[model samples]
Target: MIEAQGLTKKYGDRTAVDGISFTVHPGRVTGFLGPNGAGKSTTMRMLLGLDRPTAGSVMVNGRSYADFPAPLREVGALLEARALHPGRSARDHLRWMAASNGIPVRRVDEVLDLVGLPDVAGQRVGGFSLGMGQRLGIAVALLGDPPVVVLDEPVNGLDPEGIRWVRTLTRTLAAEGRTVFLSSHLMSEMALTADHLVVIGRGRVLADCSMPDFIAEHAASYVRLRSPQQAEVAALLRRNGLEVTDVDGELHIQGRDAASVGELVGRQGLLLHELTLVRSSLEDAFMTLTAASVEYSARQQTPAGALR
Candidate 1:
């Protein structure tokens, strides 16, 4: 297990990571998520002991990474894909890492095969494609057969096949009782990959919960109703103390259920053309949660008939 107690990092006048504390447990994939520049990478760096925290500390298996008896055997990480020497072959790279940890040279071949890079093991890493490089990086991480694994944007440049491979590989590792803490900005991917989530905004914890609970809490649900008397139906729904938005002649009602909406329309004797419930997606929930802390918000779309 990895525990971060009030881990805080400040660079000059700017605070990169606030006093955020969370635990990453074994046997599950915990996703570290936030918008770009939201201190995700900084926090991961502090967790790996690459950067000194201005306050607090992170412990891997009840000790700081450097304090662990065999750090590589206990904790393995892939902070960046191209971190390896460009001139070295993928096989040679893992071999050196194995040597550092006093691991058998055959263990290097096992990890290369584990990451499905056996054929390209002899090729220089500089000539590897982005997806191949990511695979090679993962191979290095698994070379030590660490109990705790941390990966940052492991699917950054993979094709669909490569992405699926990573998804299966991560799940398999977690299933074997390893601590998998992964970082990614892809909400859809996280929805599929993560069992738990640690969400951050402005270097602070926004949420730490199970994936299902996070969706149930943060993702909104609404009912869409359309009627010939659109404006009247909207006003009626609004009068019931529900928020309504007009979308293409449909009334999108918030904070109300479908059965309640149906009853309301029935009581009003309104002839409805359509009424459907829509659930906000995980992506939408993530965006809504991090919007204010988003370093770059996209340009707002103007309503129809606005001044051009």
Candidate 2:
């Protein structure tokens, strides 16, 4: 498990990461989310010991990252910024890493094949495409079969198939009892992948909870009803202690499920044309939660006559 306690980082007059604390447990995929410039990168850097923190500390498996003699064999990570000798072949790169950490040379080919780059293992990465580069990076991370994996935007530049492959791979890793910490900007994919979430805004932890709980708390849900007797139906819902709003000859109801609302309206002899539940998606909830924390904001301009 990865444990961070009072993790903080400051740069001159700017404070990047505040006193944030969270735990990433084993046997599950924990997603890290935040708006741009929210100190996510800095926090991750501190976790990996790439940057010295101004205060507090982070530990992987109850030890600092540098304490492991064979670091790759204990913890694997793929950060957004990659440092590579572009002229080196993909296979050779992994071999060099494996050699430095006392990893077996034969493991190079295994990782190459695992990442779907066996056919082009000898090709220099300088000429590779963006997606290919990402695969090679992942191969480097998994070269040692570490127990902890930290991936930042692992699906970046990947095609649909590659994306699916990453999703499956992360889930498989977690199932194998490894700790997987994933950070991605793709909300739809994150929703499908991560079992837990750690959301940050302005260098502070906004939320840390299970996937379903985060959405249920931050995202709004309402039942929409269209009927000839909209007024009566709206009044009925209001009388039942439900919040009802009238819009465009339709009733929007809160505090009740569609099924219960339909049953109530039916008992009142109200003829219904439509009844549907609308729940905001992860992306929607994220936007609403981080609206004020955004450093840069743009006012959306709609086309003239776009709204009635």
Candidate 3:
């Protein structure tokens, strides 16, 4: 439902997003993931037509977002929680937005109820908590019932309950054949909430695939072995050209499967206390992929404290 063709954005001599392209399809949630300073926000801005791209363009439903007759009715976005007026009651704020967009006042209440903010509709936004503010923002986004919904860091400051609520809402929206494009740094949450993922690093597209395919391709499956004769097992595995590491008194063998390791250990008559397969986590896989692209990595040590 959304597509970007070589989208690029620059500031002075630096490129915030460098000629990256990806797509968001309907009937599923597409997660846009990247570490801090990875141009996720910039790309979203360009997609929403809030920021002009230095090159290329983005389209919503085969047309530029700017060309849509009624943008709110075609594309709904909560880029941040800037949709609310601090002094206006939630109901009044939504009412005004609806009125300005030619949307019915009834939609304001329907969306408020849908987002679980009906009870506090009369309360001023200034008195709302962060989660409440997020809910209010979501209500406005859904006010138009747009086919495409784009949310950036929707759960930035939400409590666990609020986070789950957002997750459920995202899945429900996708289930109903709506296009849900979300950007978040929470890999675990994305793993659960998104079926497809687009990973970006250093303002470039790092990986884009189904969630399961992404994990299987980037994450390694290793055979973990433990034996009291740790040194012998390590030597044996190394001689067979397997990369092995001894951590916390257990031997970790990479590049080999469980059956192969079991067969080798049995042939060598090595007494094995434990042996199992260990799958690399999605977080680890992501870190490994983007480790080199990290713009500013923390230092492990500092200059010798000026010789104290």
Candidate 4:
């Protein structure tokens, strides 16, 4: 497990990270979400002991990262997939990293196969494609078989198949009771992969909750209905104190779920054509929650003036 309490970071006069606290527990995948420059990378750096926090503390397992005798064995991180030497072969790269951390060379091959890079293990990293480079980075992170894994944009250059593989890999790691903290900007992928979410905006903790709870709290969920007696059904719903909106001849009922809406319509003897509970999507919820927190927003440009 990873525990961060009042973590903060500063660079000169600018504060990169505010005091934020969140816990990443074992047996689940926790997604770290934020827009660019929201201090996500800074927080990960501090967690790995790459950068010193201006205030507060972060612990991997039960102690600070620096306190571990074998840091790599306690936490495996893939912060930057291209942080390897271009001239070194994938095998050589892993071999050296394992040697430095006192890990067995055989473990290198195991991770290579685990990441499906065994065929290119002897190829130079400079000649590898973007996806291949990402695979190598993953292999490096898994080299120590650490219980805590922190990955930043693990699917950056991956194809659809590679993305699916990564999703399964992270889930499997969590299923094995390992603590998995994955950071990515892909909301659709996160929705599929993460069991929990930790959303940060402008260096502050915007939300920390389960996936379903986050969506329900931040975005609107409503029941959509279509009926031959559309006008009557809408009027009835409104009189019953439910807010209803008509769009393209369909009624969107708010403040009630599908079952309640259906029951109300049935009791009124209204024949319904369609009814669906439209739960807010993860992307929708994220946009709504972070609308005000976006650092760089593009303003709409007015077309050439025609009048006034």
State the C-alpha lDDT per candidate: 0.89, 0.92, 0.89, 0.94
Across 1-308, the per-residue lDDT of candidate 1 in tens digits comes to: 99999999998999999999999999999999999989999998988889999999899989988777657788888989898898999989888888888888999889888888999899999999998999888887887889999999999899888888889889999999999999987788888999999999889999999988888787788898889998888888888899999978778888889888999889989989988899777788788778889988788888887965
lDDT of 2 by residue, 85-162 (tens): 889999899999999899999999998888899999999888888899999899988988999999999999999999
Tens-place lDDT digits, model 4, residues 168-192? 9999999999999999999999999
**What number of backbone clashes does candidate 4 have, counting pairs of residues 3 or more apart or in separate chains?**
0
lDDT of 1: 0.89
Candidate 3 regions with alpha-carbon error over 4 angstroms = 239-241, 263-271, 301-308
Each candidate structure's TM-score, on Cα atoms with residue i matched to residue i, is: 0.89, 0.93, 0.89, 0.93
Query: Please, what are the lDDT tens digits per residue for candidate 3 over residues 1-308?
Result: 99999999999999989999999999999999888889999999988989999999899999998887678888889987855668999999999888878898889989998888889999899999888888888888888899999999899778898899999999999999999999888888888899998989989999999988888888887888888888988899899999998888888889789889989978999889888998776787788788877888987775798558
Which of candidates 2 and 4 reaches a greater lDDT? 4
In model 2, what lDDT does residue 302 have?
A: 86
Question: Which regions of candidate 1 fall more than 4 Å away from where they truly are?
Answer: 227-242, 259-273, 301-308
User: Which residue pairs overlap in candidate 4's backbone?
Assistant: none
Candidate 2: deviation at residue 284, Å?
2.8
Q: How close is candidate 2 to the true structure, as a TM-score?
A: 0.93
Better of 1 and 4 by lDDT: 4
